[model samples]
Target: MRSYPVDSPHAAGRILALTMIVDGNLVGSELAALSRSKILDHIDLDHADFQHLLKDLCEDLLTSTSHGAIQVDNALIDSVLEEIVHPDLRRSLLHAMWSIADADGWLADAEAVLLTRASNAWAAETNFSSPSYRRP
Candidate 1:
């Protein structure tokens, strides 16, 4: 798990930024869903900013994976979650993650693991149930 808290000032954008990386593959629907997401607004970002950040994050992930397998930075993610004290916001972030994972119509094993770890971590932090991603 590579630490991406790499001095990014975009605290809220980290969830989406990390989501794009966790699956190891980026699909069109995921990008589309992310772009259409109102969650981005709640994260203090818009579609445009999200796209820009995703692009950069993807590049970084690519660089990291060029060497070997990618891993989710659980500690870094938890640290990010720590900054978000609101239960609603944490739940929203969890939902956004599930949305990204399910965007491709199939949630890969790695994606599921990432979502589960994130949900558990968020729930532990907020003492609230993390949102689930239901297929449509």
Candidate 2:
């Protein structure tokens, strides 16, 4: 898939969309946690619009699957992370991803893999200087 522009209006939604799609499927708890975070508000999407965005993201996954390639590239993740100019937003994005992964009360192997990729990608993009600073 082609990458979106860093300043695209959908950039923030894309981040959340990727978080939801990274594990290849969305669970009820993850969706609930995402909703609770009011992420859609930040993206200027209401619930109905968010549902449509989710559908679009799922379609991209389906298309990738049909091509026999269903993986999310680390480079793509880093590109997404690069769009977040603010350190706090980057940290928040990482935290939200972890929350999604743990929402089911158990982090699946697939979820863990995606979360690690995202974390490493974000760190690489940000060039984090402090080893002691943890996600807030």
Candidate 3:
């Protein structure tokens, strides 16, 4: 599993976000519920799981990025960055940021900056090495 030291700057917010994404998919609630719960009421992490699609999205991004272990398909990172490439996945990322920013349930200035930076970074990475769509 990709390991970012807990001491790394902003690591907790990022990891917490990822965890919520992976588990939230099953937990069927929100990031808050996903984090503080165990044994989701009715869900499974394996057996025709979400990883297949999640992996490709991450590999494609990482193949073009220097984000490395901190953002690769490392099981931990997969929980979040796996969806970095999909427009549909933004919800979870946004929600996670919302969670982080609103630990007090109210967005803060720095948290807004963090969310904006993360969103831009993820979006920018997607375009860096992507081949332009061209009918061949």
Q: Which candidate should be chosen as best, given TM-score against the real structure?
A: 2
Local distance difference test, each candidate: 0.67, 0.69, 0.40
Across 1-118, the per-residue lDDT of candidate 2 in tens digits comes to 5455564436666677777777776788888988888766755667776676677766776676636868666666666656665555666667777777778787776667667776
lDDT of model 3 at position 3: 37
Q: List the candidate 2 regions with Cα displacement exceeding 4 Å.
A: 7-9, 66-69, 73-85, 127-136
Report lDDT (Cα) of residue 54, candidate 3: 38
* Candidate 1 Cα errors over 4 Å, as ranges: 1-9, 62-67, 73-83, 129-136
Better candidate by TM-score, 1 or 3:
1
Per-prediction RMSD in angstroms?
A: 6.2, 4.1, 13.0
Q: Which wins on TM-score, candidate 2 or candidate 3?
A: 2
lDDT of 2 at 96: 73
- The top-ranked prediction according to lDDT is 2
Q: Rank the candidates by TM-score, best first.
A: 2, 1, 3
TM-score of every candidate: 0.71, 0.72, 0.31
lDDT of 1 by residue, 1-136 (tens): 2333432335557667677666677778987777667777666676677677767766665665534765446664566555555677767777888888788888887677667776777677777733574546
